[model samples]
Target: MASTETVKVKVEFGGGTELLLAPPQDKRHSLTLPRKDAAGTETNVTFLIEYIRKNLITEREELFVDGDSVRPGILVLINNSDWELEGEGDYVLQDGDEVVFISTLHGG
Candidate 1:
């Protein structure tokens, strides 16, 4: 396993939001994200973007907001295009690439 010291992640949310993530002090290329739902609860999920490869994220893997495992309500944008309309997990990520996640809701 690579040391968590070398991994870095950049996230961009809906409406041009963005954040830069640094690897945990003790690990390389490892990331843990926290989430709180409407009920005011928190959940921690661990994932490494460097591990996102052709095998792990096949063309069939579902695209969720922030690449999160728990919340699949939102959609991810690849190269400024929607994965659902273009291609889902089939969209491979390249180094120094840009991906965005946006919220989804039904309204009239």
Candidate 2:
């Protein structure tokens, strides 16, 4: 069924992902986003990416995201499980779910 409720989740950034956000470059975010967007479709990872890009990211959008997904070399995990295993962008978010982004492209 279509989910229309709001979902509270924890979003985290690592592997230099925090550099794209505003200072003091906090990596953890507690967000409440609609379960269904303007089109009334369930809010999933794909939707969350757009929402974050528009609302949370301060600059360098191209570095954090590409197209409708994370740029190549960025790793996404939901509730500690790889996003690919959870249907990638199609995975429906659950309340209290933890989403993490790590950029593998960064050099130490």
Candidate 3:
């Protein structure tokens, strides 16, 4: 039988993205996700992004997610590598992986 272990990943927000979370200062999040969803598919970045938006974000959800993906100008990195190089939202999450979001947008 396959072990239905959870994957623990570290997620961080920066470059003004932290404002979406509570206190507007807390930026680091350690998350655990089931290895597979109810459909038996492995958890991916797309799922994690929504999970964070729904569960962790305290405000400004639009600043983080849009139309099933992260809004433009928000840079995502997986394990210190560019998410673009890691297949973007299709990249399957692994235990101990580090995901980071940095918003390039700034208030006027």
Q: All candidates' lDDT scores?
A: 0.37, 0.92, 0.89
Candidate 2 regions exceeding 4 Å error are 1-4
Across 16-93, the per-residue lDDT of candidate 3 in tens digits comes to 888788774678988889898788889999999989888878887998899889999999999999999999999999
Query: What TM-score fits each model?
Result: 0.36, 0.93, 0.91
- The backbone clash count of each candidate, in order, is 5, 0, 0
Better of 1 and 2 by TM-score: 2
Model 2: weakest 10-residue lDDT segment is 1-10
lDDT per residue, candidate 1, 1-108, as tens digits? 533323223345542111222222111132222233234433211232323322133332333224533145556665567667644554433333355555464346
Enumerate residue pairs that collide in model 3: none
Point to the candidate with the largest lDDT: 2
